[model samples]
Target: MDAMQMALPIVGIVAAAAVTFYAVSFAEIREKSFEDLEDKDFESGGFKPSFSSRQRRARRKADKEGRK
Candidate 1:
């Protein structure tokens, strides 16, 4: 029941908490798959479809609007 014994357990618990926190963060950072990165880049940059495909889509939309 002395202060030394009391302090030992507290120190151990704190150390365990710090180690666990670091390990989880490391695993999370490592878990970012390449596919996930590509998806993020595509989302951030907006969709970059081929120019021909985009022009076709625009024409189709215009045609639909003209008939409306």
Candidate 2:
């Protein structure tokens, strides 16, 4: 009974520490995305590049040049 009682507080403390660590890590990651967005001008429709759009444009250009 004494051993179980001692173990209970130790377990609680460990669980609390784990929860605190995860919360801090999540907050840090969440802030990074917001920071990146803040650096861009959202009012100008935020010039974000898309990989697919670039690829499609290049393919169309190549096709057009090949036909000539």
Candidate 3:
């Protein structure tokens, strides 16, 4: 077989795999959206920040006792 003919199928397989990966990723994100809406962490006013976003936790600097 010609080199071009052999290469074309390989390219097509890679393209198909990429399309499938994206489709599954989007589906999982959509499912997570519904779960987030049902979460109990929301504040009375609005959604609460995730644990990692809290003021104390998000601070990167050392505390007064630890500072030089």
Using TM-score as the measure, name the better of candidate 1 and candidate 3: 3
Best by lDDT: 2
Q: Which stretches of candidate 1 lie over 4 Å from their true place?
A: 33-68
Query: Each model's TM-score, in the order given?
Result: 0.49, 0.57, 0.57
State the TM-score for model 2: 0.57
Error of 3 at 68 (Å): 73
Candidate 2 lDDT over residue span 1-68, tens digit each: 69999999999999999999999999999999889878999669896666698899999999999999
1-68 per-residue lDDT for model 1 (tens digits): 89999999999999999999999988887677644655765656755556698889999999999999
Q: Each candidate's lDDT (Cα)?
A: 0.83, 0.92, 0.80
Clashing pairs in 2: none
Give lDDT tens digits, candidate 3, residues 1-68: 89999999999999999999999999999999978777756667656655464656546444644675
Q: How accurate is candidate 1 locally (lDDT)?
A: 0.83
- Show how many residue pairs clash in every candidate, following the order shown: 0, 0, 0
lDDT of 2 at 31: 100
Better of 2 and 3 by lDDT: 2
Winner by lDDT between candidate 3 and candidate 1: 1
Candidate 3 Cα lDDT to native: 0.80
